[model samples]
Structures are given as structure tokens and as C-alpha cells.
Target: MLDARAHPSCISVAVSRAVGEAYAARNAAAQINCSETCFVLAFVPGDLDGRRVAAALEEALEGVPVFGCSSAGQITPHGYETDALLLLAFPKAHFRCSSILFEPLKPLSTTAIATAAQRHEKTFSHTAGWHRLGLIFADGLSKQEDVLISTLETVLDDLPLFGGSAGDALRFEDTYVLHQGRCYGNAATLLLLETDLPFRGFGFDHFLPGGTPIVITGADPDERKVFEINGAPAAQEYARLVGCAVADLSPQIFAENPLLIEYKDRHYVRAISDAGEDDALSFLAAIDDGLIMTLGQGQEIIRTLQSGLDIHDEQGRRPDFILGFDCVLRKLEIEQKQLGRAVSEVLCSAHVVGFNTYGEQHCGVHMNQTLVGVAFFGPDQRTLY
Candidate 1:
């Protein structure tokens, strides 16, 4: 195992007020000192040209393989930000990296996601099975994550995948994908790293069912639409229970009281991504009958943060970094509670530096209310290697 003390991987982040030539130079200097062979770079610029920003980032890195997307919000040792940059560096021998790119993706399709993962595995095989875990990200615009996640599970086997979508600052308008210095839209990116690195991984999220759980009586996942809950139109029924007009159901409201789905003792919250006409509610995940659901809220971010920190301490590893995957909903919840200081406390305690995401993935499975992370214990200090 990699040592957690000596020769530990170093991580440094430089978020600029700008992403022009000025910010790129400073960010490059920080990365140059930290990364051995390569680093995972993310740019969350507030106002910048897509092509120009990508080009500047590429030039600043001096040809290092660059991959990451725009973030809705970012987390660092300092705090969260809407306009800034966050970069993480891993030593060359400390990690073997492999990446897969898929483009022009549409709504969820398990078969399509499976195929993408298979192709990614072929590329990952060259890592010589040293992949300790995966960091997965995608176009925030892609809504088929549930299908994509389940498909990757079949191919990745036991490897845990973690990361989030490239957030567009909640603009929800135009989001870009970055790979090999090129930017695109409607794409998926996966990073597989092989190493005997010592690290701990886990995440947390909470859903309080406000109403009685109802089974999914009908769904049209491909269309991103749900027609029924317990044999009744999902939107109409849910609205009646909440005493709100079905037409008034908004993404903001959907996030507060998402439809909860129960499966095998675990309950998953499916937030409304969109509300279709005529009492149809589109969800972030697939909805089928027989699954009990209740309206949920982000009331437990404080608890989730505490539990996440507890789990991190139990990992038996000294963390160099904690890569996080938090949903945008969590971001909103933070603002609601005015818990920025408290949230930063968790990162400071764990020594975390990561970005907020659209939707998070783990073990090749999509998830929410979870802070999927890998806490590094430098190989130079451990006997695992």
C-alpha cells in the first residue's frame, strides 16, 4: 500500500477571477509543481469563450492531457464558488490513467451505456489492473445517467466510479465537455486509474418521505416522462397530495419534494427534472409501479456532511485529497441553510478539494445524497505497494 505520510501526492488549486492568459499561467504553475505525469483539470469560469478558454487551458498546461468540465459550483479548502477553477494532481507512478469518451448521447438507455463502458474497459485494460477506482464525469446536459451508470457497472465489475457532471453554473443552457484539449457537447468521460494507492471511499445523502410511499404504476423513461404513481397520474396525484397545482411543479419544487422510490430496503429519491403537460412528471431516474415514494427534502445536508466526515475518519488513511460528487440540489440546500462555513469545515477537516456536479456516480452506478470520494494515503508511506 502507498504510504500515507512520506512522498505523499501533493494537491494545490488556483481559482482565478479570470480564465484568460493571466489565470491560466498561475493555474499552470500550481499544477506543474504538483502533478508528476498528469493532473485532472476543471475550469468553472463564469464569463469566458468556450473555444478560447479551452485553448488557453491547453496552452497553460503545456500539453498535459486535460479533461474536465464546467462546474455548477466548486468546493475547495477555502469554500464553494460559482466562478473559479479547481485542479488536482496525481504523481506518475502513483497512478495509471485511462479515459473513455462518448458523444451525441441522448436519454437513458442501458444497452447504450453498457456498450460505452465496454469500450472504456478496453482502454482501461492497458492500466494493468492497477485501477484503484474511477472518476467519471459527463455533459451536465445529458439526462440518461441512470442508464449510463447501470451499464458501466456490468463492465467495471468491482471498481468504484466517482465524479459529477460539468455544471454550467445552473444556467442549464449551454454546457461544454473537455477532452484532450477539445471541447464538445452531449458527451461522457471516464477516468480509470490503476495504483496500489491507499485511500478510503464513501458518500452520503438523505431523503425524508413527506407522504406515504406510492408504487410506480407506469413510466416512459425514454421520453423522460412518468404518467402514474399507484395507478394514478404521477404529477396530478403528487400535486393533490401537496396541495399545489400540477402546472406549478417546477425543478426547484421537484428538488424539495422528489418522488422517493423504494427498492430492497433502500429508498432512492428521484427529483423532478421536468414537468410534462397534462399531469406528467419527468424524473431524474426511471419510475416503475410498486415502488413506494414520498416527497423528500435537503434537510439533512448538515447530517450528511457530518456522517461523511465520520466515514472519512474511519477509512484508516491520511487523505491527500477527497474527490467529491455532489448534486446541484445539495448546492441549493447549502444556500438554503446558510451553512457555507459548516460545509467548508468538513472539507478543511478532510483536506478536500473538489467540484459540485449535476449528478454524481459511484461504482458505475448513478446516485444522489451521496458524497462519493477516494481519500488518498500516499504509497510512499504504506506497505500495500
Candidate 2:
């Protein structure tokens, strides 16, 4: 277990399962002494016991607005972890957070989301010289993130949105978002934060395109599936290029190698979810016919990740805290390459507070295998490591 208090307004803790849930929640909240706390918790398959965690945290937080979600893996100040609970506390002195729970997200309308954003902004726009950003946690299984994020963008209007889809430890059965103390599946929780700090929102992946280029010829945009690449079966062609048989296509292969799509002269990763029995490929983000894709080659991950983090340092300010939504596939790539410690060191040095997500939301688009986050820089604070 690790506890870190970065500033008078922010603190973080990683609690192990060995500690009783109630004791851990109460003690961690008290130690941080913040009004807005986000907790990332471990999910036990078929347990569906969010009530236990919610009740305990609520008892400790004492009506302070608490929000979070289940995670595939939690990131703390120390490193990556499983079967642990991580909490990030943001005190009212430097930060103000307001959340709205959209229950039954399937039926979520754009107007309702916009109204929520407007309402939240009106309530808290009294503060000045503070940066604003949105943090979102949605049910990963609901498949409604694309619409919800875009709708909220209309209201946020360049305020910048960054976050992730909540995961249930790879179970893929059900995932939930937490608001206050209740767990809601098929729901989304949106938090609008006003921080008295110089903030920058960023998204990046550590992969570069290679010479291999493929084009989507047949697809189901709604389902995010591509059946043909360059008029050939997606699985077969992808496997051929990656030096594997179609039958051997797996998530691990997709993680080690990704497909890239060019947007405005830069390439963004389009990760594969899995290969289908029909030789189709499902992507984490939406894909449509006529989109050209190029195979990507990964860089030295540790160096690439550090370079990404170093961007803030190059800008004459380093982040005091970074609320990151890291893709689970990236985490898989780190484990496959045995670079966990190095990557964790970078995240720890950057003071990242977040969890591994099934998919990440950046700006207004839902993308795969990307680390999207908001870096908070205070005039009085600097990098710790």
C-alpha cells in the first residue's frame, strides 16, 4: 500500500485487500482530507458487490462527492496493481468537481447531456484563473461512449474532455460507474472540474507507422468491425503481414502491433479488439469502409513513454498531477515486453492518477490504446522526480 500527498489540495492512496474495506476507506479519506475523491477498485467476477465498497467509502467521506469506477488494473503513486483500491483526493481549495450520473446510458440523449454540462458549469463558473476539463467514466459494456462523449462536447465547447471506459477486470460481462456511493451499470458519470492550475490536456500512443498500408473495403461502422482490408479478409491479410496465420490472430498480436490512421498529418492508433471466426476484425474505435490503415511498429516503449511525459517539462512547466486514462492494451504491451517497472516509474514520476481502461476518450473521440490525460501545473509546484 502507498499513500502520497502531493499538495495541500491533492492526495492519493493505494490500499490492499488485506486491510478491511471500511477501515481502509475511512483512513484514506481522513488522511487526504479532500472533498472530492475518486476511487478505483478491483472487481471480483460474479461478485457484484459494489454496495460494500460504496457503503464503506460513503461512511468515511461523509457526504463529500465521491466518484470512480471499477478498473481492469489500478495505477497508484507506487505502480500498477491488482486487487487493490486507489483513491485520489482533490480538496476544494484548489479544485472544484461536480458530477452528474446518467443512468441507463443507452437512452442518453444529447440534450440531456448538454443540459447537465451547462448546469454544472453555471453552478461553478464563479471561479477565475482556473482551467476547466471534463473527466468521464462510462460502462464499457454499454457501447454508448461515442455518442455520450460527442454530445457532452457540444456543451463543453473546447473545454477539453479526457477519460476512459470503466472495465471489469477483463470479464467483459459488466462494468459500472460510481457516483456518490451507488454503482450504476449501463450508466455514465461525468465530472466537470475547475482547477486553479495551469492545465494541458494530452493524448498519445508509443507506436509509429511502417511501410505496410491497408485500406478498409468492407465494414460495419456501428459495430466497429472490418471484414475486408484491401479487398482481402482482414484477419488473413493482417496475419500475413504480421507473419502469423489467420487462426493465430490474438489480442497479444494486436497489442504488439497496431493499425494506424492518419488524421491531420499525424497518425493515431486504431487497435484491434479481436479476430472473428469469419476472418473479420473488430476495432476498439469506429471504422468505416474507405478508411486507409497502415501497420504500426512500436518504439522502445520506456523511452517513448518518457518522451511523451517530458513534453510538459519542455513547455517550461512540469505537471503536479496527471489524471490519465491509459488503454488496457498498452498495459498488456508493457507486460508482454516486461517494461512494467520502467513504465510505472515514469507514471509515478509524473504523479498519474487513473486506471487501465478498455477504451480511452480524448477531446471528443473514442480511441483505443491511447493514454489521454490532463496535466495540472501549479505555479508553486514542480516535478518530484
Candidate 3:
């Protein structure tokens, strides 16, 4: 068990590897001061029972609102952790939050979502001088992020949003997001937060467009599956382009060589999740017929990651902490290159906390194979609320 208390900072983090939900919750709760917290965020291991963990946390915190979801893995104080339950406590002194839950994301009603979000934004009283931002946790397997994020962005204009799709490790099966002490699948939650601290939102990847542009000839946009690329079977063409047999294709290879799409003169990674039936390729982000993409060439992972997290303000002050949403595909590539320890050291040095995600959301777009986060810096001049 690792417990970290950030004195003079408003956020407290606790991590526990205890066997059962009760023990884990108790162990984590003992490290935080519930009285000082407005709410708690819990990242439960995908392998653990989220319902039991919810119950245990409810009992442990005694009514402090808890919201979060299952994760592929966790970023604790000690770095990447797989089997631990992690909790982040946001103190009432520095932060205030209001959350909205959207269920049945499959039959996603865009108009309804927009109206509800607009209403929530209008009704939630905002502080005069505090910084406001949005955080979303959605069911990763629902395949609904592309539309959901776009809708929220339209309605909640000017409010910066950064979020992650809830993951169930590598199972690629069921995933859940917790709200009001219950775990809900096929659902999403949005937390609108106001904080007095200075902060910045960022997203970065180590890839650049390298190969000839390939067109997606046939695809199922709703399912995020590509049946054909460059007029050939998706998987077969991908393998040929990468100089490997179809059978030699795997997650590691896909991570090493990803697809990049150019939008607004900027390139973004479109990661592959799996090679499926009938030579189809499954993507982590949205896909469509006639969309153009190119193979991405990677740079030094450690250097790029370090440069990405080496953020500082004009005053030369680093962030007190960062809430990060890192793609699991990136994690796979890092492990394949034997850079886990080095990456973890960088994460620890930067004070990053959060989880590995199936997909990441930033700048009004759903992306993959990228790290998106918000870094919170301590207030230079303290002011009374």
C-alpha cells in the first residue's frame, strides 16, 4: 500500500492493493481526511467488482460523493499500478463540482444531451474568479464517445474538457462508470469543476505522418471497424504496409505503427485496437469510408513523453499535480520497448495521477494513442472564497 498526502495542496491521493474491496477501501480512506474533501474520485481495477468497491467506498467515506470508473491500469504516486484501487480526494476548500449522468448512450440523443448540458451549465452557479473545466468518464466499450464528446463540446462552449474512456483492462468486454455509489454500464458522467488553482490542459503523442496516404474504402463508422483500406482487406493491407504477414500482426505492431489523420492542419493518431473477423480492423477512435490516413512514424518515446510533461508557468513553477488519461496502446508500446521503468519515473517526477484509457478526449475530439491531461498549479496569491 502506498499513501501520499500533499500538504499545502488541496488534493490528496491514496492507493491500496489489499485483497478485498472492504480492506482496500478502508486502507485508502484512512489516508485521507474526509472532513476536508468535497468529493472523491475512485479508479477501481477492472478485474475487481465495481459494485462491491462502490459499496465499500460509500461505507468508508460516509457520504462523500465518489465518482469514477474502472480503468485498464492506474497511475499512482509510485507509478503504474495494475491491481490497486486508487482514490483522489478534492478538497472543498479549493474546488467545487457538479456532475451530470447520461445513460443509455447507445440510443444517444444528441439534441437531448445538448439541452441537458446547457441547462446544467446555466444552473450550476459559477464562482467569479475560479477556473472552470469539465471532466468526463464514459464506458470505453460503448463506441459512443465520438458523438457524445462533440455534443458536449457544442453545448458547453468555452469550458475546456479533458477525459478518458473507462477501460476493462485488455478484456475489451464490459466496462462501467460509477455515479452516485453505483456502477453503470453503457453510461457516461460529466463533472464540471471550479477551482481556484491555476491550470493548463494538454495532449501529446510521439508520432508523425510518414507513409503515403491510404484511403479507407469500406468502413462501419458506427462500429469503428474498417473492412477495407486502399482497396484491399484492412488487415492484409495494414500488414503489407508494415512489411509483415497478416498472422504476424499484433497489438505491439499496431502500436508501433499507428494511423494518422490530418485535421485543421494538425495530425492525430488513430490507433488500432484489434484485427477482427473477415480481415477487418478495429479502431480505437471513429472511422469512416473515404477518410484518408497515413502510417505514423514514432520518435523516442521517453524523450517525447518527458518533453510533454515538462510544463511550467511563466513564473517557472511546476504543477502541483496532473490528472492524466493515457491510452493503453501507448502503454503496450512502452512495455514492448522495455521503457516501463523509465516512463514510470517520469510520471512520478511530474506528479501524474489517473489511469490508462481505451481512448482519450481533448480539444473537442476523441483520440487514441495519446496522453491527455490537466495540470493544476498551486495558487500564487491565496484568496478567500
Per-prediction TM-score = 0.83, 0.87, 0.96
Q: By TM-score, highest first, what's the ranking?
A: 3, 2, 1
lDDT of each: 0.65, 0.74, 0.89
Q: How close is candidate 1 to the true structure, as a TM-score?
A: 0.83
Candidate 2, residues 1-385, lDDT tens digits: the string is 3434322134344444436666656655566544444333223212335656667777777766668787878776766665666667665667667778888887667787788778877786547666677788888877778788878877778577887988866667768888878878999888877766667778888888997568899999877889998899889888988999887887789998889898778787888878889999988776899998889988887887787777565457667777788888898889887989888878887777778887888767877788887777765543221
Query: Per-residue lDDT for 9 in model 2?
Result: 30
Clashes of each: 24, 0, 0
Return the clash pairs for model 2, or none: none
State the displacement of the C-alpha of residue 335, model 3, in Å, after optimal TM-score superposition. Answer: 0.8
The CA-based lDDT of model 1 is what? Answer: 0.65
What lDDT does candidate 3 reach at residue 174? 71
**Candidate 3 — worst ten consecutive residues by lDDT sum?**
1-10
